[model samples]
Target: MNAPPLELLAARGTDLLVRVAAVACAARELPQLAEELAGLVVRCAEELTFCDVYVLDDDGRVLEASNRPPVPLGDADVGWVAAHGCARPHADGRGVAIPVRCDGATIAVVDVRSAGRCRDEDVALATALAGLFAPVLSSCRRLRAAKEREHAAERFAERAVEVQEAERSRLSREIHDGIAQRLAGLGFHLSAAERALPDDLPETAQQIALARRLCDLAAAETRAAIGGLRPPVLDDLGLSAALATLAREATAARLHVSVTVSGELEDALPDHVQTALYRIAQEAVGNCVRHASATCVDLLLEHDRDRVRLTVADDGVGFSIQDVFAPGRRPDSYGLRGMAERAELLGGRVSVTSRPGVGTTVEAVVPVPASRGRREAGGPG
Candidate 1:
C-alpha cells in the first residue's frame, strides 16, 4: 500500500508531536506513554515495519520495553544512542535508534525498523519526537518524586503520633501507680490520725482532717490527669463506653450533649481506629463548644461488620467550610485539618458540612479492614 507524501507526513507528524508532549506531560510514568510513542513512530515513519520504545533500568545497563516484550533486536545501536545522546543508523540501512534526552542525559531510546532502506526524513522525524518527549518525561519524573515525598511525610506524621501515644501511656502508668498510690497511703494515715484525735484537741483534729481532704482531692485530680493522658475506660471497656465518658466529661457549658452508640460489631474495631474515632469526636465537640455556640450536640457512632462511622452534629452558628479550609487562612484553633490528616493516615475520611446559621455535621467513615491492616500500637485515645 502507498503511504502519504513525505512532506504531508512530516507536517502532520510535527503537529501531533505537540499532542504527544501533552500526553507525556500528564503521564506519571514512562509506561503510560508507551503506546502513544510507538504509534507516533509507526504512523509518521510509514517505511518502518515496527517501532520499539526502550528505557534504561535503574542500573542503566539493561533496557526495558514499555510497549511490548523485549526481543533480540540483533542491533547494538540502541545502546550507542542511549550512551552518546545521538541517533545511530543501522549499518544495513533498515533501522535507526534515536536518543530521548533530558538535561543532557538520555532517558530513553527509540528504535524504528523498516522493511527496506530507512528514509532520512523518517530518521529525523523519530529524532524530533524523541526531543519533544524528553521535557515531558522530566516533568513526569518530578511529579512522581513529589508524590513519593508526600507519602513519606504521611508515614512520618503517623509514626510520630504513635510514639507520642506510647509516651502518654507510660506517663499515665507512672502517675496512676506511683504518685496516686502514695497519695492514697498518705490519706489513709491522715484519716487514722484524725480518728485517733479525741474530743479534747479540736484544733489538732481539724488540721488533720483538712490534710486528709486535701490528699483525697490530690488523688482525684491525679486520676483525672491519667484519664486525660489516655482514658482507661477506652482500654477497660471499649470505644462506646469511652465515647459516653467523653460526652459526660465534655466541657460544653451551654450545649446539651448526648452520645448514642449503636452497632452490631462494636468490639471489632482495631485499637488505632477506636482511638482515631475518639479523637475526631473530641475535636468536633471542642469545635462546637468554642466556635459553634450551639444549644445541643449529638455524638453518634455506628459500626457494621465492614466499617465504622462516627458523626458529630451540632445545631450551632455554622460557618462556611471554604473559609475554614482556605489555604493559609485556617483559624488558630481549628482541628478540622488535623482531623482530616489523621483520618487519611489511617485510610479513613472526615467530611464536614456547615453553613452560616444552619448547622455543622462532622462525619468520619473508616474501613475496618484497611485500618486493621495498618494498625499501630497507640494513638490519641
Candidate 2:
C-alpha cells in the first residue's frame, strides 16, 4: 500500500490532538476519560483494526477497561508494558503496547492492534495521546485521595461524639442508681434513729437532726450531679419540656428566663436529635447566666414540616463571637464547640451572633425525620 502524503498525515495528527484535548477538557471523572480516550484512538487511527484503554492502579492492577470483552489483567504484554514503563511491539507485527506516565511514574497502559504491519507514525501517535491524558489522570487521583480523607475525618468526628454521649449516659446512670440510692437510704436511717432516741436525751436528738440535715444536703448534691451529666427531663418529656425546665431553673438562679413554643411539636423526633438540641440549649443558657451575666434570656423552639429550630437569646453584655471561636483565642470555649459538634452530628448547624455591649443569640437548626409528620402552627407560649 502507498504511504499517505506528509501533508495529509500532519493534518490528521492535528485533528487527533484537537479531539483528544476536547475529551480531556470535557471529562469530569476517570472512567469517562478512559472511555473517551479509547474511542478517540480508534476513530483517529483509521488504519488500526482494534484499540483498548486500560486504567491501572498504583500497584499496576487493572482498575477499568474501555473496550467490550475487555483485556484481562493476566495478559503478559499488558503487565510487561506497565512494569517497564516503555512501549512494546508484538513479535508477530500485529500490535503495539504503550505505557502512560505521569510525574515520571507509569499510571496506565494503552494497547492497539492492527490486522497487518503497524506503521511507526501510528505507534508515535498512540504514545503522544497517552501522554496528553497523564495530567488529567493525576488530577483525578489527587481529588479522590482528598475526598477519602474528608470522609475519614467525618467518621472520626461522629465516633468521638458517640463516645462522649455514651460516657455521659453511663455516668448519669451510676450517679442516679448508686450514689443517689445510698444517700436516700442514709437519710431514712438517720430519720429512724432520730425517732428511736429517748425523750430525755435532747442533745442526742439535736445531733440526730444535724446528721439528717447533712444527709439531705448530700442527696441534693447527688441529684444535681446526675442532672448535670444528663438531664432526665430530656428523655422523659422531649426537647421543649426539657428546655422549659431549664428555663425554670435559670429563673430560680435569679435570671429572668422564659420558654416559648411557636409551633405544635406533638410528634416525637429522633432520640439523638432531641438530646443534641437539649444539650445545645442547656449550654447556651448556661453561658448566658455564667459568662454573659445576662439578666433575661428567651428560649424559643419552632417546628416545621422538615426541620426544627431552637434559639436562645439573652439581653446582656456580649463579647466578640469571632474572637471566642478563633484558634488559641479562647481554649475554654469547649462548651460552645461541644454544642456545635453535637448539632453537627445530627446534620444540624449551630450559629452564634453577638457583638460587644449587645445581646447574643445561639441558634441550632436540625432536620426532622421524614416519618415524623408536621405539626399545626400555634401561638407562642
Candidate 3:
C-alpha cells in the first residue's frame, strides 16, 4: 500500500521546525551558496533518530546527503517530480517517499528509509523540510529569469541601431541623386549661356558672366553636398559602375586610385547589398583622401554564391581599430562607426585592420539569403 499525502506530516510540530530551518539556512547561505542542504535530515538523524535523508535540485539529482547511500535520481525522476508538482507520501520496501517543496513548487522527492517502517514524527520532519526548501528555490528562479530579460534587452538595442542606419541610407540616396543632379544641370546651362554672350554687350555680358560664375560655384557646392549624402552613381548605375565613377572622380581630383571587381558577378545582387558596398567604398576613398596621406587606393568587389564582400585599402597613415572603439576613446571619424553598424544590421560583419604606418583596410561581409534569387540581368540601379 502507498503512504499518506504530505499534508498529514505538515500538521505535526517536529516537521514544522525542520521546514523553517531549511528556509532560514538557504537564505543565509546565499550569493555565497554551496551544495548540501540539510535540516530535517540532520535533526532527524541526531535528535529525532530518523533513518536517512537527501536533498535534490529541481532536476531530482541528489544534491545534499546525510546518513544515506547516494540516491539514484536521473532524468526520469525529475520528469516525475515535474509532472506532479505537489507533496505526497509513499511507502515502498524500506522507506517512504515524501515530496520536497521549494518556492511552493514540488521539485524533488525526499526518501526517508529507516531500517523499518518510519514513525509519524519522521514524516512530519520531511514535510517541514519541503517548506524550507521552497523560498530558496524561488530566489534562484528569480535570478535566472532576470538574466534572460537582460539578454533580450541587448538584442532590441542592436535592432534599433540597424533601423536607424537603413533610414540614413535611404535618405542619402534621395538627396544625392535627385535634388543635387538637378542643381548641377541648371548651373551647367547657366555657364554655357554666359560663355555664348556677345562681348560687345559689355554691361549685359558682365552681369551674365557673374551670374554664370555663381551658378558654377553653386553646382560644385551642390555636388559636394550630394557626395556626402550618398554617391549618385551608386543609386543610378549599380556598385561596379558607381565604383568606376568614383575612381574617375578621384583621378580628376589628382588622387591615384584603382578599382577591380572579381568573381562572376553575373548574378545581380540585392539593392541594399549594392548600396552597402558602394557606401563602404565611398567612405574608404574619402577617408584615404582626407586622413590617409597615401598616393594610391584600391577598391575591390567580389560576389560568390553565398556572400558578397567589399574591401577598401590605401597605402596611407593608418589608425588602430581597437583604440577607436575602446571605452572612453573617441573615434577619429564617425563614418567608421556608421559603417560597422550598417554591416551588423544586415547579419554581416565588418573589420578594420590598421597600424600606425600600415594602411587601413575596411572589409565588409554580408550573407545573401538563399531564398532571394539573383537577377539574371545586370545589377540593380
Highest TM-score against the true fold, candidate: 2
lDDT string, candidate 3, 1-381, tens digits = 133434444444556556555645654332222123343454544233333334454344543443435454442332344346543343343445555666455544555556555666655665555455556645654653454464354355445644654676687677667776776777777777778877788998788778778777776776676575666666688889988988988886678888889885445765666666676777788888878888888888878776888888889988877777787686555888778777776667888989989998989997653322322221221
- Candidate with the larger lDDT of 2 and 3: 2
Predicted candidate 1 versus true structure: per-residue lDDT over 1-381, tens digit per residue? 123334433576566656555656555465566556777778766587888888765445665686455433323787777777777888998998878888877777888999999887677777777776677666655654564565465456557667767898999999988999999899889988887888999999888888888999999889878887898888888888988888777743666789987777634676767778887887888788788988889889987766789999999999888887787886733589878877887767999999999999999997664232332321111
Rank candidates by lDDT, best first: 2, 1, 3
- Model 3 CA deviation exceeding 4 Å by range: 1-215, 227-232, 235-237, 326-331, 373-381
Runs in model 2 deviating more than 4 A are 1-10, 13-22, 42-79, 89-97, 111-125, 198-214, 230-281, 298-312, 319-357, 361-381
TM-score of 2: 0.64
Candidate 2 lDDT score at position 231:
83
TM-score for all models, in order of appearance: 0.55, 0.64, 0.45
lDDT of 2 at 228: 73
Tell me which of candidates 2 and 3 scores higher on TM-score.
Answer: 2
The better candidate by TM-score, 1 or 2, is 2
TM-score of 3: 0.45
Estimate candidate 3's alpha-carbon lDDT, on a 0 to 1 scale.
0.62
| lDDT scores in order | 0.75, 0.76, 0.62
TM for candidate 1 is 0.55
Weakest 10 consecutive residues of candidate 2 by summed lDDT: 372-381
